[model samples]
Target: MTIIEQYGWNTVWKDKWNGKYREHEGRDLLPGRIIGDFGSKFRVITETGETWGELAGRLRHTMTDSGEYPSVGDWVLLAVQDGGEHAVIHGVLPRSSVISRKAAGNTRDEQIVASNVDTLFLVSALNDDFNVRRMERYLIMAWNSGANPVILLTKADLCQDAELKIAEMERAAPGVPVHAVSALLGDGREALLPYIRSGQTVALTGSSGCGKSTMVNWLSGRMLQLTQDVREGDSRGRHTTTHRELFVLPEGGIIVDTPGMRELQLWEDEGGLDLAFGDISSLAAGCRYSDCSHEREEGCAVLQAVAEGVLEEKRLLNYRKTQRELLYQSSKEVKQKRKSAAAAVKAGSSRSRNSGWRKEMDEY
Candidate 1:
């Protein structure tokens, strides 16, 4: 058993990944989390913060093999540098949960928000930053990541009354915990610390100006980073936190904080849509046909609910919109994946043929 298994990192990622664990074990490779990442380099922290470092060539080469690139919350195989603070990251283990979004500005592929997380603290400042639809998008992505989702409404003091907002959040996120907190006021912050226990990993994601950095500073008992206030013209805050980073909570456990996302688009997780639009699903099951479209159909239970005030029509529309978006993304990703696979196979065959020709010429 590896030290990660002993320390519980292996247990968290065992079922989610299958990699060269036994080969990479021992003094060379240790388990570490990607805390701070720029474009090419990343800052990693293991149980011993002293061993923190960056990735090696092999891991970088293999990153294109799948969607297992290192993110802030990733548990990676680290090759310790014998004499310096820098260590070489050899490989990335599997992730039990991964939160992602369609990278902004018409990117074909998705961007991994965080990985290997146990809990997703979906932060939303209660001031002008709150939006039910936007919250739903994050909630869907969180649920799709396979982590337990909890809503953290920060800047609660800024809102005139939080009860109504909390109520709305509860409605928007059914069966999910909704807590309004103020990092400045120190109110309702304690309620969330239980989940930040030792050995587990919690990831925080929300728009900029949501006080994620402030929350991290408060949780860690020191200033981890800086923060800024929202503008007077708009309730939306400025981008104080720029990158996604991991931090060790002073109380226990680990936390990953991300820069605010002004534009969060859906990716390929449909289970999230099913869970988020559960009311629509439940209503649809009662539809007369097995494959009911729930639109203008006479026996559509969903339409009936919309007419009878049981379900909001807008809610159903959003569900369909998200579902269609998911389908479209999945289809597009599959086509791209097939194209990549075909290209890889063709390249490999060409390389093999070239090597054989070279061998024949050498024998001459």
Candidate 2:
């Protein structure tokens, strides 16, 4: 296989290039995968070799959303220049899967974590940072990402009840694979190997100081990333990974390591909430009222399940909380869209009036 093929390029991608990007081929444009995204620049790996790339002016101007720009793991068409040292990215291929979250702070924007990922490894340290509620939030984004979600309880050696934590996570994320791994001791790494075999792309994401960088170094069999100790008080590790990067393993497979997120706000939930909270959805189906809110409602199966100890009250509360967040986000997005539309109309009308005045002045 060629160099690009090892990075998950296949005949399907070639066919896509031929069908849509054929024109670029004649202009010395080549297909490359983005391995690193550093704000204004990108590190892309083509068959020729690795090169630094920046978006072409036209492509940059046309892309209005942050998610629309090239990110780590994106396949893009680029023109190599400066004797292969630099490149100009022309376009990005359609992504098979994308992981996104809300941009930090009060902004109604989407941040694309990674694109074209096949599997998402949600890592949480088994220390004080371990929170099942946080894991549930990650699961919602994972399910929405079009990638298979696998929970990785890291730093197992630090925790006395590693198995218990794994079981708890399993219960929280039904139908998803859960494993406890100690990167320090190299235990439980074997179970994760299958997901990182040749041509497979797996992304590791979790809160900062959760052992994602350690896992990357261990899996790559080298110190590909720097590791730091967590704070003694809070068990929170400093942000070891400052950016998202794609690394090709020595043996085979691919891994995308991302910086720990301080805040994980929901972006857009398209049935991800239901998938992440499958147990609650399943219980809700038996409610007498089809639209039962499960809060003080008669014949609410969900409430009954919680009361009878079949479901944890905390879990149900988290489900409701995430549901509310998604609803509120949706409303804000609708309002923003309307506001933008009105501004666009007003701007167009002003432009037309100005143009008419200019024409009248010229005729006069």
What TM-score would every model get versus the actual structure? 0.90, 0.96
- Writing each residue's lDDT as its tens digit, candidate 2 over 186-205 gives 89988988899988999999
TM-score of 2: 0.96
Instruction: Give candidate 2's error at residue 55 in angstroms.
Output: 1.2
lDDT of each: 0.78, 0.91
Q: Which stretches of candidate 1 lie over 4 Å from their true place?
A: 1-22, 25-27
Q: RMSD for all candidates, in order, please.
A: 3.2, 1.7
lDDT of 1: 0.78
**Residue 314: error of model 2 in Å?**
0.1
Candidate 2 shows a clash count of: 0
Candidate 1 residue pairs that clash:
207-260, 208-260
Q: After superposition, how far is residue 193 of candidate 1 from its true place, in Å?
A: 2.5
